[model samples]
Target: VKEICSYMGVSSDTVYRWVETHEMPVHRMGRLFKFKISEIDAWVKAGGANRKPQKGNSQ
Candidate 1:
Protein backbone atom coordinates (compact mmCIF):
# COMPACT_ATOMS: atom_id res chain seq x y z
CA VAL A 1 0.00 0.00 0.00
CA LYS A 2 2.80 2.36 0.89
CA GLU A 3 4.60 1.56 -2.32
CA ILE A 4 1.52 2.21 -4.41
CA CYS A 5 0.80 5.38 -2.50
CA SER A 6 4.23 6.64 -3.43
CA TYR A 7 3.79 5.54 -7.01
CA MET A 8 0.40 7.19 -7.35
CA GLY A 9 1.29 10.28 -5.37
CA VAL A 10 -1.78 9.87 -3.22
CA SER A 11 -2.44 8.92 0.35
CA SER A 12 -3.10 5.36 1.49
CA ASP A 13 -6.67 6.31 2.32
CA THR A 14 -7.23 7.46 -1.26
CA VAL A 15 -5.94 4.17 -2.63
CA TYR A 16 -8.29 2.20 -0.41
CA ARG A 17 -11.17 4.41 -1.42
CA TRP A 18 -10.32 4.00 -5.11
CA VAL A 19 -10.21 0.25 -4.70
CA GLU A 20 -13.72 0.37 -3.32
CA THR A 21 -15.17 3.04 -5.60
CA HIS A 22 -13.17 3.11 -8.84
CA GLU A 23 -12.36 -0.56 -9.35
CA MET A 24 -8.69 0.01 -8.96
CA PRO A 25 -6.96 -3.23 -9.91
CA VAL A 26 -5.58 -5.00 -6.91
CA HIS A 27 -4.85 -8.45 -5.59
CA ARG A 28 -5.95 -9.39 -2.13
CA MET A 29 -3.94 -11.95 -0.19
CA GLY A 30 -5.36 -12.68 3.22
CA ARG A 31 -5.29 -9.17 4.72
CA LEU A 32 -2.70 -7.77 2.36
CA PHE A 33 -3.23 -5.82 -0.86
CA LYS A 34 -0.69 -6.27 -3.61
CA PHE A 35 -0.23 -4.04 -6.64
CA LYS A 36 1.54 -4.42 -9.95
CA ILE A 37 3.17 -1.44 -11.61
CA SER A 38 2.11 -2.57 -15.04
CA GLU A 39 -1.50 -2.88 -14.01
CA ILE A 40 -1.43 0.52 -12.36
CA ASP A 41 0.16 2.08 -15.40
CA ALA A 42 -2.48 0.60 -17.64
CA TRP A 43 -5.25 1.69 -15.35
CA VAL A 44 -3.91 5.23 -15.35
CA LYS A 45 -3.47 5.23 -19.09
CA ALA A 46 -7.07 4.12 -19.41
CA GLY A 47 -8.19 7.01 -17.18
CA GLY A 48 -9.49 4.92 -14.34
CA ALA A 49 -8.20 7.36 -11.77
CA ASN A 50 -9.67 10.44 -13.35
CA ARG A 51 -13.24 9.56 -12.51
CA LYS A 52 -15.12 11.87 -10.23
CA PRO A 53 -16.73 10.47 -7.15
CA GLN A 54 -20.46 10.14 -7.49
CA LYS A 55 -22.87 12.43 -5.77
CA GLY A 56 -23.85 11.41 -2.22
CA ASN A 57 -20.69 9.30 -2.09
CA SER A 58 -18.23 10.24 0.59
CA GLN A 59 -14.56 9.45 0.31
Candidate 2:
Protein backbone atom coordinates (compact mmCIF):
# COMPACT_ATOMS: atom_id res chain seq x y z
CA VAL A 1 0.00 0.00 0.00
CA LYS A 2 2.77 2.37 0.92
CA GLU A 3 4.62 1.56 -2.29
CA ILE A 4 1.53 2.16 -4.41
CA CYS A 5 0.84 5.40 -2.59
CA SER A 6 4.37 6.60 -3.26
CA TYR A 7 4.26 5.41 -6.85
CA MET A 8 1.00 7.27 -7.42
CA GLY A 9 2.37 10.30 -5.53
CA VAL A 10 -0.60 10.33 -3.21
CA SER A 11 -1.06 9.70 0.49
CA SER A 12 -2.09 6.36 1.97
CA ASP A 13 -5.31 7.84 3.19
CA THR A 14 -6.18 8.86 -0.33
CA VAL A 15 -5.48 5.38 -1.67
CA TYR A 16 -7.56 3.76 1.02
CA ARG A 17 -10.35 6.24 0.46
CA TRP A 18 -10.31 5.59 -3.25
CA VAL A 19 -10.41 1.85 -2.67
CA GLU A 20 -13.41 2.34 -0.46
CA THR A 21 -15.20 4.84 -2.65
CA HIS A 22 -13.94 4.42 -6.20
CA GLU A 23 -13.37 1.49 -8.53
CA MET A 24 -9.61 1.28 -8.17
CA PRO A 25 -7.81 -1.81 -9.44
CA VAL A 26 -7.21 -3.73 -6.26
CA HIS A 27 -7.63 -7.11 -4.72
CA ARG A 28 -8.07 -8.13 -1.11
CA MET A 29 -6.77 -11.25 0.59
CA GLY A 30 -8.09 -11.69 4.09
CA ARG A 31 -7.33 -8.31 5.68
CA LEU A 32 -4.68 -7.30 3.17
CA PHE A 33 -5.10 -5.37 -0.04
CA LYS A 34 -3.08 -6.18 -3.15
CA PHE A 35 -2.35 -4.46 -6.46
CA LYS A 36 -0.59 -5.34 -9.65
CA ILE A 37 1.95 -2.94 -11.12
CA SER A 38 0.92 -3.64 -14.69
CA GLU A 39 -2.77 -3.23 -13.89
CA ILE A 40 -2.06 -0.04 -11.98
CA ASP A 41 -0.10 1.30 -14.91
CA ALA A 42 -2.93 0.47 -17.26
CA TRP A 43 -5.44 2.00 -14.91
CA VAL A 44 -3.46 5.22 -14.73
CA LYS A 45 -3.16 5.31 -18.46
CA ALA A 46 -6.92 4.86 -18.68
CA GLY A 47 -7.47 7.95 -16.51
CA GLY A 48 -8.36 6.03 -13.40
CA ALA A 49 -6.26 8.24 -11.24
CA ASN A 50 -7.49 11.40 -12.88
CA ARG A 51 -11.10 10.58 -12.19
CA LYS A 52 -13.06 13.07 -10.15
CA PRO A 53 -15.78 12.09 -7.75
CA GLN A 54 -19.19 12.27 -9.34
CA LYS A 55 -21.64 15.01 -8.49
CA GLY A 56 -23.91 14.15 -5.56
CA ASN A 57 -21.46 11.43 -4.52
CA SER A 58 -19.66 12.17 -1.27
CA GLN A 59 -16.04 11.27 -0.97
lDDT per model vs. reference? 0.87, 0.84
Angstrom error of the Cα, residue 30, model 2: value is 0.8
Task: List RMSD in Å for every model shown.
Answer: 2.9, 2.5
Off by over 4 Å in 1: 53-59
Q: Pick the candidate with the highest TM-score.
A: 1
Report the C-alpha lDDT of model 2 over 1-59, residue by residue, as the tens digit.
99999888999988987787665788999999999999989988998877976655545
TM-score to native of every candidate shown: 0.82, 0.80
> What digit string (tens of lDDT, one per residue) describes model 1 on residues 27-48?
9899999999999999999888
